[model samples]
Target: MEPVVQFDHVTKNYGSQVAVDDLNLSIEAGKFVTLLGPSGCGKSTSLRMLGGFEMPTSGRILLSGKDVTRVPPNKRNVNIVFQDYALFPHMNVAKNIAFGLELKGLDNKSIHRRVSELLELVQLQDYANRLPNELSGGQRQRVALMRALAPDPDVLLLDEPLSALDAKLRQQMQIELKAIQEKTGKTFMFVTHDQEEALTMSDTIVVMNNGRIEQMGDPSTLYGRPGSVFVANFIGETNLLRSTVLGAEGNLTALDWNGITIKADQGGLSPKAGEHLYVVLRPESIHCSATEPTSGNRIKGKIRQRVFKGNHTSLAVEVGDGAVLNTLVHPGDVAQLAGDDIWVGWKPETATVIPDRHAHR
Candidate 1:
């Protein structure tokens, strides 16, 4: 299948600062692709470029195999749902949804048909006569989605559409948005700084940093096997351990961290005899015990703090070598309290080796 949207070596600059730098990505038809990164990472800039609100300094953007880099926003078959919803206060819900069609000079009868269909699509048919001010945050968001979808754009671009809502409403809208996308089957390209939102809604996630594509993959793949230190650290909480590659035999690579030896996969990259490496261990993967395990790489640590987060408990342990490991254990299995000594261990496969980047160290 051909990619519906493609960015080839894309770069965007403002004055002397580069916002998006040499980004290359592809999104398949009807796929929900998210541009995810923290603020100033250029995810929003990339979205704007795709929306035709901004032009790339270099490279091209292809929509359905046609170059739309120079095309104006309205001329292209794309619509955006802004964070603020961008609905006019004077326009009722029905008129707001019909606004796009009206600008295109559609007849009143056709506009009513399209708007009605969209209102039902977003499950806001009953709110058609209501004003934007009268609607709740989630309801207003639905209105925004209806307006964007009323045009039947080939792609829908969402710019943090749920960011303005309260936390509970944001969570509710995330579910609603995903359901709407699946029901409509339209290509959706969303931009968000929230990693959890991207992971939950995206068919494919593009992790960007410093205006460049850091990693792109399915949520599980990106989360479980982050290609870089930045990706691993950014995607979730992890214990980043600085170590040195000791030796490798077959699939197992031995690493030495402050004289503490541990084994991991070879990671496909050959390491020098004393080459520095970093290990990323997820909190859930680390097993904490009151006593040291007979097998595996076990380390003793004093629990610095504990946080009970409903389902599980998070323990911050201060191990040797100036390293702190945050481990999550089941509430039922948690044995030690703050200031108590405990042993943490994990299987060789649990820890993945990444580049020894300074940010991770």
Candidate 2:
């Protein structure tokens, strides 16, 4: 299928500072794609370039196979919902949603029908007459979303639309926003620093850093098999164990960490012998036990500290040369593990290896 949006080697600069550095990406039709990264990473700048709010220093941007790179924001066939919602204080819910439709020369009856459909879509039909200030934060958010949808644009740009709500409400809205996107089947290009929100709502996530695309894939692929050290650490907490590649064994690769030989999944990358790499070990993937296991990938370690985390406990295990690795274990399992001595091991397939990229600047 042809992409609904495309950024062809787009580059944006602020004086001498490059905000977006030669970004090339494509957004498929009806797919929810998210640009995820930290502050000053240019995720928002890319969104604005596509929205016609900012123009690139070089290259072109196409929307639905048309070049809209140089077009003004008001002339583009796209709508944006900012963090503030920006609903008129005096206008009620219905009027706010119908504002865009009316601007396009739609009749009153048609505007009413479309507004009603959108209100019912968000389950806010009863609150149509209420003013924006009178409704709750979530309600106002829905109104802003409905208003953006009123124009029936090719894509909807959301700039941290739910950042204002409290934690519980924000989480609830994440699910609701995804459901709404699925129901409408519109291409949603959202921007945020929240990894959980990106993972929860995006059909494909684009992890950007240093004004470039680090990795782009489905949530499971990005989290489980990260391509770089930055991606492995940015997506979630992980234990990156420094190791030297030994040799490949079937589907696993032998790694020499400190003085201990351990095996890890190769993840389709051929690591040459004597090359420095890091094993991406998830906390939950490491199994802690009081006795040595007669099975896969066993190692001896001392439990340095334990943190109670409600349903489970986080164990900091000192494996080699004061390198502390964290593992999640059942709280009751360590009731009395004979002091701090324990075995922290994991299956060879559970851990994957990634080449060391030094560290992010």
Candidate 3:
């Protein structure tokens, strides 16, 4: 399928400082794609460039296979929902939603019909008469979303649209936003630094850092099989152990973490003996037990702290040499294991070995 949006080696620079560096990405139609990264990671910049709010310093941008690198924001067939909601205080919910339709010279009857449809789409049909200030934060955000969708743009850009809301409201809005996207079947280019939000709402996640694309893939692929050390650390909480490649035999690679040797799948990457590598182990992948299990990978550690998190208990186990391994255990099973010496084990396939670029540091 042709991409709905494409960034061809785009670069954005402010004098000597670069906001985006040689970014090349493609957004498929009807897919919810998220640009995810930390502050100043160039996610928002990439979104802005797509919206024509900022032009790239070099390279081209395409919209539905059309070269729109120099197209003005007003001429582009796209809409944006800003982080602040950007609602007109004087306009009520209906008017706010009708603003885009009215700007395009649609008849009053058509505008009203579209507004009503959008209100119902967001389940805010009763709140159409309410002004922006009269609604709750989530309600106002829905109104902002309605306004953006009123025009029926091919692609909708969301710039941290849920950032202003509280945590509870943000979670609720994430579900609503994803539902609305599916209902409309519009290409969504969402920008945010929230990993959970990206993982929850996006069909494709583009992980960015240092103004460049670090990795892009489905949530499961990106989370379960991160391509780099930065992606492994950024996407979720993982125990990163510095290890040296002891040797490789067939599909398995042997790594030495301090004095403990463990085997991990090479993941198709070949590393010579004595090469520095990082073993990525997810907390949930490690199982904690009172008795030693004759299993795959096992490490003996003293439980320093245990946190009850309703569904699961998070235990911080110190293995030695100032290294602590985090393990998540079932709540019911962790009642008697707090503060005790425990054995943590994981399957060899669960651990991934990636070369560490900053191993010296």
Best by TM-score: 3
True-vs-predicted CA distance for residue 61, candidate 2, Å:
0.6
Q: Write one digit per residue (lDDT tens) for candidate 1, span 176-288.
A: 88898999999999999998898889999999999999989999988887888889988988887778988886676799887788887656677666888888789998899
Where does candidate 1 have its weakest 10-residue lDDT segment?
331-340
| Model 1 lDDT on a 0 to 1 scale | 0.88
Task: Report the Cα lDDT for residue 28, model 1.
Answer: 91
Q: List per-prediction Cα lDDT, in the order shown.
A: 0.88, 0.92, 0.91
By summed lDDT, the worst window of 10 consecutive residues in model 2 runs over 352-361
lDDT per residue as tens, model 3, 32-117: 99999999999999999989999899999999899999999988899999999999999889989998899999999999999998
| Per-candidate TM-score against the hidden true structure | 0.94, 0.96, 0.97
Sort the predicted structures by lDDT, highest score first: 2, 3, 1
Q: Provide the RMSD of all predictions against the true structure, rounded to 1 decimal.
A: 2.1, 1.8, 1.4
State in Å the error of residue 64, model 3: 1.1
**Pairs in clash, predicted candidate 3:** none
| Better structure of 2 and 3 per TM-score | 3
- Residue 213 alpha-carbon offset, candidate 2, angstroms: 0.2
Where model 1 places Cα greater than 4 Å from the true spot, the runs are 335-339, 357-361
Q: Give the TM-score comparing model 3 with the true structure, all chains together.
A: 0.97
